[model samples]
Target: MSQITRIKGSHRAASLVIAGSAVTTSGLVATAEDAVDIRAQTRSVLSQAEALFSRAGLRKSDITRVQIWLADMADFPAMNEIYDAWVDPEHAPVRACVGAALANKHYLIEIQVYGYQPD
Candidate 1:
């Protein structure tokens, strides 16, 4: 079995997983200590995901798949607005966004990313 490595964020969860050159993370929510509105929370989640990518020696362009969970479908536009700004449109990966209950009510968005590093 490939050893799984966890890339921990400033938050308590050690969610990011690494095996071989592949990297994947669990749903990451807003990093703001205080409760934030949907727009702000969405941005925060993306920022945190970016940080994780950096830690894993991966770039947004390396992402192969992206999964997003929103507390409300209405937040789609808001989440994509920030996400579109963060990801490279020319090399965009497969993605899915759906409305679902999150770990925290304060969280408006959560994202998981998977990427592979060239050997």
Candidate 2:
């Protein structure tokens, strides 16, 4: 078994972690100007996720699954507008999105990603 390694730049415990060929991240949320705006927030979250994937030497296409949490279900359409554009149709990850209260009231959406690389 391989020792787990950590990815910096996220909150404690929920930061990105990698062991062997797989990469896992704590739920990603928006910050600064992005948090309150549904579109910006969704974009910020994906950008954060992309940065994590890059840190793991992977790409958005590498992600196999994702779970999205939305603070308001009414924001779903707006969030999807950004998400549908960000993900590649051919390699789109299996995904789930649900409305829920988030850790931060300002956060409109949160995302967690799972990705893999073949040895």
Candidate 3:
């Protein structure tokens, strides 16, 4: 049977949680210091996602879905460049990218992932 574990300080609507060996959700937010570039923001988010998954005992190949929110659509391609290099090609996750004003104006992107771990 699958178990669900929720991480504290995450969004109630889109929080980080682990669901047994079948699924896990990444953290809902990303923050950064002022004067950072979009690429740096992307890297930070990816790093956080990796750490979150690692802590959950999950791997990149386990990812099944991803939703990315961008402050500007123009950044999608750049974000994809980084994202593509981040995940395992053989196990690419289904993804959606859209432009939306983020929590803080300085943040260029925020990503949420849904993944499955082995039994």
- Give each model's clash number: 0, 0, 0
Predictions in order: lDDT = 0.80, 0.87, 0.75
Clashing pairs in 1: none
TM-score winner? 2
For model 1, residues 1-119, the per-residue Cα lDDT tens digits are 77778876547667688888888888777766624677788777777777788887778888899998888999788777877887788889999998899887778888888888766
Better of 2 and 3 by lDDT: 2
- The number of the candidate with the highest lDDT is 2
In the range 19-100, model 3's lDDT, one tens digit per residue, is: 6765555534556452276677777787777777787777787789989999989988888888888878898899888899
TM-score of 3: 0.82
Report RMSD (Å) for each prediction in the order shown. 2.3, 1.4, 2.5
RMSD of 3: 2.5
Locate the minimum summed-lDDT window of 10 residues in model 1.
30-39
Judged by lDDT relative to the true structure, which candidate is superior, 1 or 3? 1
Angstrom error at residue 11, model 1: 11
